[model samples]
Target: MNGNRFGRLFQVTTYGESHGEAMGVTVSGCPAGLELSEEDIQGDLDRRKPGQSMITTSRGEPDEVTINSGVQDGYTTGTPIGMVIQNKDARSGKYEPYVTAPRPSHGDFTYSAKFGTRNWGGGGRSSARETVNWVAAGAIAKKILATQDIEVKAHVNQIGDIEAPEVTWEEILEHSEENEVRCAHPETAEEMRDRIDEYQKEGDSIGGSIYFEARGVPRGLGAPRFDSFSARLGQAMMSVPAATSFEFGLGKEARQWTGKDRNEDWEFDENGDPTPVGNKHGGIQGGITTGQPIYGEVTLHAPTSIPKKQTTVDWETGEEKEIQVVGRHDPVLPPRGVPVVESMLQLTILDYMLLAGRINPDRLDGQVGEYQTDYHPRSPDNMKE
Candidate 1:
């Protein structure tokens, strides 16, 4: 409950359960005068919503977003922006069987142990559905970042054992959304879709990783040590439900590399600015941004809820039971997770920009307490001079 909020300056607080009335969020610290509409947020929600394709859950929620407050004349008012997405297709009856038994590798047990009781309907606040609120808030952040020329994007790069070949930014923009798998490589996406179909038929699930990148982020947006750019980004990526691992440039692979091999040499750019020759550090050096692209991957474990029979104990009866998690659920995660990853990237970058004072928290125009010479008329006496 206390951890529902994220960020220091640009704060985002979410509420509601997965199967409850609706999921909502209050986004504070957004500067006034920025253009925002429900449509801007709905596009991202559409990508993350369930029932997107043959591989996703069958729940038919439209995931339409409604902006409840904090806008007038189509611009943010610098107040808390309230938005909500109602749960139209949540079926509580299917989850009743596992209410006491708890699902394997899920937060059901821990939530019960800590809260003494839980909603138990579609996993409540512990559900990945909560990310709907995240993607909503991230849409606003992305809009704000766009004003500063920052861009965030992601693609499903790995599905189970099948991995797509490395792709350029242009390829991701063009091909990532052309298929169901959200992989940038078309052939690899087909293979990934087939693999997901195999798992769905078997009533099992698979895991994969998403590659995300942020470009046009200014340098010196983060601090050293605990507040490093990479540190905050890691926290953002790891917070995604089912995410098991996170890595940046070189990442774990850096273990096999010597200091000399991993090190990136610096040189002066044509504009006379210092720049790294290579991006082995993923655009960060000494925990701060270096004006290069920030790129990384987040690995999500297989979705735990599956129709395949799994054993668990019924806490209410104090007896063992075999449970088949019969319900609409995704056979794999990365396809739906691509947008979530991009959202997190945008949110993290915007928060850091606000913290670094690179962006004015009061307004997007960055003109605070300054005279509006263009709007104000000079006195008649002064005009004679």
Candidate 2:
């Protein structure tokens, strides 16, 4: 319960369970007077909602988000924003059989061991259902970043062994949603879809990676050491269900290169601004944005609730048994995870921008920027006023 919160200035605390009555998020530190509505948040929710495509879980939840508070007359009030999505199609009965034998590669056993109890229905807090809140909060963060011309995008880069070809930002924006797999390449998207269908027939699941890019990010947005932007992004990605690994910019590939090949040389642009000749660092250096596109990838593990029987120990009887997981689950994760990844990046970047004081709080109220003419240092008396 204590670890439900995320971020420093722009914070989000998610609550509820997979089969619980409702799942929701409380977003705090959002600037006041920004335009907001249920529609703005619902658009992203619809993409992440279950049953939208054949490749995803068959559970038919509308996943409609309702704004409970924090906005008045279509604008934010700078208070904690509360939103909820009722779980309509949660089938708890299907999971009754697994109450004794915990599923392999799931949070059931560990959660029960840590908390002395667990929600057997749909893996409770461990379910990908928890990401609903994150997407909702991220939608709002996206709106905040839009004020500064920052945009975050993600696409399915690979599914099992099927990998998508290199795609540009425009291609990702224009074509990612054309298919269920969310790959930018049309042929690759179809192949990924066929692969998912093939695995779904065998009652199996597959995992893949997602590529994330943040464009138009200004410089000076990250702190040093502990709260580095990359560290925050990694922590956010790791918190998602089934997310196994994260790497940004040549990540593991950098291991093969020497220091000279790894270092990106700097040059002056036509505008007299310093720019990197090559973006080997993925647009980040010394824990701050480098005015280049920030890019990364998140690798997800295969969903554990396959239909085939698996060996496990019964928690109550202390006996070994084979259990066939029942109920609907995703055959692949990257497509749905694309929006989730983009949202987490938006949240982290917006929070860092706030902490860095790059964007003025009053900007939310239609004011562009606050300027000062005096250069005199502030004394304790001036600060008090």
> Considering every candidate listed, which one attains the maximal TM-score?
1
Task: Score candidate 2 by TM-score against the native.
Answer: 0.94
The TM-scores of all predictions, comma-separated, are: 0.95, 0.94
lDDT for every model? 0.91, 0.88
Compute the lDDT of residue 107 as modeled in candidate 1. 95
Segments in model 2 whose C-alpha atoms lie over 4 Å from true places: 366-385
Tell me how far the alpha carbon of residue 74 in candidate 1 is from the true structure, in angstroms, after superposition. Answer: 0.5
Model 2 C-alpha lDDT per residue in residues 1-385, reported as the tens digit of each score:
5789999889999998999999999999998767899999999999999999888889999999999899876777778999999999988998887787788888888888888888889989888899999999999999999989999999999999999988999999999888888898999988888888888998899999999999999887787888788889899998877888999888899899999999988899898999889888988898888989999899998888899878899879989998888789888888899999999999999988888887665446445554321221342445665
- Candidate 1 stretches with Cα past 4 Å from truth are 370-385
CA shift of 80, model 2, Å: 0.7
